[model samples]
Target: MKSTVEQLSPTRVRLSVEVPFDELEPDFDRAYKQLAQQINIPGFRRGKAPAKLIEARVGRDAVLSQVVNDALPGKYSEAVTEGGVKALGQPEIDVTKLEYGETFEFTAEVDVRPEIALPAYGDVAVTVDALTVTDEDVEEQLKGLRERFGTLKGVERAVENGDFVTIDLSATVNGEDVEDAKTTGLSHEVGNGQLIDGLDEALVGVKSGETKEFTTTLLAGADAGQEAVVSVTVGSVKERELPEVDDEFAQLASEFDTVDELKADLRERVEQSKKMNQASEIRDNVLEKLLELTEIPVPEKVVQAQADEQIHEVVHQLNHDDDLLAKALEAQGTTREEFESQARESAEKQVRVQLLLDAIADAEDVSVDQGELQEHILFQAQRYGMNPGEFIQQVQQANQLPSLFQEVRRGKGLANVVLEAEVTDSDGNAVDTKAIFEPEGDEADDAEADAAAESDADAESK
Candidate 1:
């Protein structure tokens, strides 16, 4: 067997392979055995017929066809290995020559990873928003905590914003009642705007036992995109009475015994959350900078696949109803064309990022150990709300373990880039990225334990 490569483009190649007849003996034998089990012979027992006898019965053409079909995959793989081709997707195979007693030749065209000239990781620089916690931030957190501990009490007054109310809602489309849009005793916050449009405005200033009618276009259901007259009856109005900001309130709301202590804890939490946001900003900016510095040739097929997948998911979520999809786009102030264009652009960027990160992983020799892979599997399982054992089985069945491994490797590669890059805050001060990226001792131990448990679960399932 011999193979040579032709570079059709930076991101694609064609492999030309030729295999002599002598090299296909094993394939021929396997094909003959398979055929012998399926074809009957007058004198020989089932599956016991000789290859020559089977060939004579089935004709030489039939035997050659079976052998060729059985030999292509292995031959293609061998050619790919020998040529050091990093094939992306399936190859387009073309059999150029095939003769019984002569040579077999074929050509395969495939997408491949292009050779990328990467910028120095150390030279990459990005600026992120400075981590700042102000009195307003602490006050906001305190307000949230207070709201959580507040008690709702009946108020004999007109409905107001920030008040909770129980209401009965009914809707009609073109003077016909919409059964699915009618409900009673639904509790809603007046200012939340969680229900239909114009609902908040209708509820505001309405007294108890008062009903207000408003017209708005329905965004979902069978009557989607149709104008509906909705009538809301306020059953009761209530206000949240917040506990005073005192030591007694602090003890009731939190573990802290003093209000001052609670405020301090809330401030610390706000600071920590801001730092997390800063780390995220740094990651995004660093990636953007890397993309700006590197030249990654996106494979068209890969980008198309990604875009198709996104569109498929959107359609699936919309129950494959084109009308519903259109209504959704209209509600978002976009059209189908705009959505597709955005999807394509997003897909191209995503493909470029994947390719760039893969190159970085290779350059850094980034590897995912069993523990790290298990940890990632566990995280994904939790995210998707699946049992670890079940998730492992599903991934294994789908043959997605390699993809998962690549994801982890790419993540590590990005982390390496972030570690090496120079990241500073908007105020021109160097940010302490290590504090956000590096796990502390306890967290590391917990992560290891989770990984071990995930591995054990997977082994049990197997």
Candidate 2:
């Protein structure tokens, strides 16, 4: 067998392969056996017929067709390996020749990964927000903590913003009652704006036992996407009573015994949170800088496929109804054309990032150990609300391990870039990014636990 590759473009290639008849013996044998089991020949048991007789019964062309179909994948893979083609997606193959005893030939056109010229990571620099925690920040954190411990007390006044109210709701779409939208005794905050449009406005200044009517579009149910007149009957109104920020309150809300100690801890927590945000900004800006500096040609097919997938997910959520999807876009103040354009842009950016990071991983010779892979698996399982065992099984069944492995490799590659790049706060102070990106004591312990859980998950799956 011989294969030669022709570069069609920077991101695509065509491979032509030729194989002599002698190399097809194994494929012919398997095809004959499979065909024998499907056909009935007199005086012969099932799958016991000779190749000559099977060929005579089904025609030689039929046998050769089956052999070619069975052998194409292996032959294509071998040609790809021999030609050193970094194929991205499935190939379009065309059989050119299939002689009786001479040769079989075919050509495959596929998208290929483009060669990348990587820039020096040390030369890349980005600026992020400074990690600053002020008195106002600490007080905001303390206020949130106090709210968590706040008590609700019955109030004898009109419902106000931030007040909790128990209300019964009924709705009608086009003068017809929407049964699915009717509910009794639902608790909602006056200004939360979580339930429906115009609800918060109508609830404000309403007293207990008062009923207010408002118009809102029903987002779900049989009458979804239709404007409905909703009636909200306020059953009771209550105000949240927050305790004073004193030493006694500190003991009740946290392990700290004094208000001063609690405020100090809150300040530290706020600073830590800001550090995380700064780290994320650094990572994103570094990637953006690299993308701007480099020229990476992405496969148009892969980008289109990803865009189609994004659109499919949105359509799927709308129950595959095109009208519902259009309505949803309208509700969001966007057109289908605009949404598609955004999807394509997002998809192209994602593909470019993945390809660029993959190139970086290759250049750095980054490798993912079993523990790291297992840790990622555990994290993804928790994200999807699945046990590790079930998640692993689903991943294996779908042949998605390679994709997950690539994701981890890209992450590590980006981390390497972030480590080498110069990152500074907006105040021009050099930031110690390693403290945010690198695993610390707690993270290391979490990795160990993830490994143990992976062992358990493997056992459960088996």
Candidate 3:
């Protein structure tokens, strides 16, 4: 077998391959064996007929066709490997020549990984938002904790903001009842704005058994974007009574014995949360900077394929109802054209990011060990709310293990870039990015546990 490559473009290639007849003996043998099992030769048992006999029965053209079909994939893969072509997606193969004893020739056109000139990692810098946790932030956290422990008491008065209410809601568009928009005895919180547009305002000040009517545009269903007259009948109103912020209340709510101690812990937790948010901002800003500095040309075919897949998924979620898609887009103030345009743009960006990170991973010789891969799989399973074993089996069945492996490698690549780049807060203070992106091995875990135990001992001693 001999192969050569033609550069179709930076992101694509055409491979010309020629395999001599002598090199295809294995393929011919397999093809003949397969045909022998299916063909009935007078003196031979099933799968025991001679190749020449089978060919005589089925014709040489039939045998050659089977051989060509069976040989193409392996031959194409060999050509790609020999040519060192990093093929991206499926290849389009065209058989150019197939002689009786001379040679079999074909050409494959495929999308290849483009050559990317990586930017200097040391020169990359990004400024993220400063980590700031104020008293109000701690108070907000405390308020959430209090809300979780609050008691709901039935109120005899009108519904007010922050009150929970049980109500029956029915909507009609132009006097025709909207079946999808009607529900009975739904519990909602006033001022939460989780349900319909004007539901919160309509619920406020409505006493039990009082019905309020409001006009709002339906966001989904058949009448989406059309104004609907909604009738809401309040069944009951209840207010949450929070316990006082005292020592006793602290003991009741947490292991802490005093409100001051609870506030201190809340403040520390809020600070940690703010730091995490800062780390997230740094990751985004760093990626944005890298994209700005680099010029990565994405393949149009790959982008189109991804965009089509995304559009298909969106339609699938909508139950393939074109009208529902249109109406939903209308309610969101977007048209089908705009939605497609946005999807294409998103797909292009995603492809660019994947290609760029993959190149980085290759350049840095980034590798994902079994442990890291397993950890990533577990994380993904938790995210998708699937059992680990089930998710693994499903991904394996779909042949998506390589894609997941690539994802892990790309993450490690990006983390390497982040570690090399300079990151600072908005206040011009250098951020401790290593702490955020660095792997916490067993040593780090042991250190953390020891520190925690020491802190607990100190608290007890005090």
Candidate 4:
């Protein structure tokens, strides 16, 4: 088979394939034999029909059609390979010419993965959050530790900060008891300012069995937004008794002897966490900067598909919000169209970023460590609350391990670039390496935080 190709676009190509008569001969013979075996001719035994007789009955066209069907796939693949097609999806094929004892030719077009030209991806400087963990951070973690083992003692007085209150809440929207409305024995920490506004204020000065009414936006349930009147009667209130920050408390809370020792250990941990986070942030910034400097072309189909995925995610979240329709219209400027457009933009960015990153990965010979892959798989299984063995089996069964490994390696590659960069704070102060090496709370999703990052990058690139 001989071939020629045309570059329609960075992400698209047109391949012209020509399979010579010599290559078509074997398929012709196979087609004749298969047809002769399947058809019934009186006084003829199976496999006993001659090629010439089969051809006479079926005609040249029929035999050639079968031969064409069998031969096209291999010839098409060969043409694509020889033509250097970096395909994204299945090809669109059109048979231009097909005749016995003549060259068979066809035209194929497809969406291809575009080549990328990165600009200063390595050693790119960026400003990121400082890893100067204060004494307040340590105190906060200590308080959290104390609360974990703290006993809830019934309080005879009004609800206060650090007190857990049990209450029944009812809400109405424009004086209507909406659908999916219900009550629960909800435990709330007074002054948390998380659940709903005015909740802490309503709980204040209230004893057991005392009812209070306050206005707040609904966090959940049917009346999610639009000023709703909430009626709550406190059943009980308990004050949390935290352990003292001492030698004994330190041993119980952590593997340390004294409170000072514990603080020292925690400081080291905090520093490590800060470093990891800074490293991740700087890498992300590098990508952002690279996107700003590079030129990466995005294919339309890829953008559309990505937009659909984003819209689907938004719509799913919308179902859980009561005033979601209004909120979306107000925020996005349209009910669905605007959101879809934004999604398309996001998709384009993602496709371009993936292209560039893949190019970088190729250039640097980036690869995943086997031990790390196993460890990451096990870690994910635990996170999703699944057994490691079962998770590994499922991941393999689904054929998603290769992609997952690629993500891990991509992160590592980004990390390598970040380490070499001259990162600083907003004030242009040089960032400290010891401080930056601390773990940034559980490695947040770069994991998920910047799903739209590439989209912005795509725009900047364009």
Error of 4 at 283 (Å): 1.6
TM-score for candidate 4, residues paired by index: 0.78
Better of 2 and 4 by TM-score: 2
Q: Can you give the TM-score per candidate against the true fold?
A: 0.90, 0.92, 0.92, 0.78
Tens-digit lDDT track of model 2 for 253-276: 999999999999998898878865
For residue 43, give model 3's deviation from the true position in Å: 4.1
Model 4 score (lDDT): 0.72
Q: How much lDDT does each candidate structure score?
A: 0.85, 0.85, 0.83, 0.72
Q: Which candidate would rank higher by lDDT, 3 or 4?
A: 3
Candidate 1's C-alpha runs over 4 A off are: 439-462
Give the alpha carbon lDDT tens digit for every residue of 1-462 in model 1.
999999999989999999999998998888888888898899889899998898899999888888888889999999999999988878899999988998989999999999999999889999988788999999999889999999999999999999999999999999999999999999999989899999998888999999999999888887877889999999989999988899999999989999999999999999877865676567677778988999889778877888888999999988999999888788777899999998898888877877887898899898778877888888879968999999999999999899778777776677778778898888999876666666678556434334323332232122
Q: Indicate whether candidate 1 or candidate 4 has the larger TM-score.
A: 1
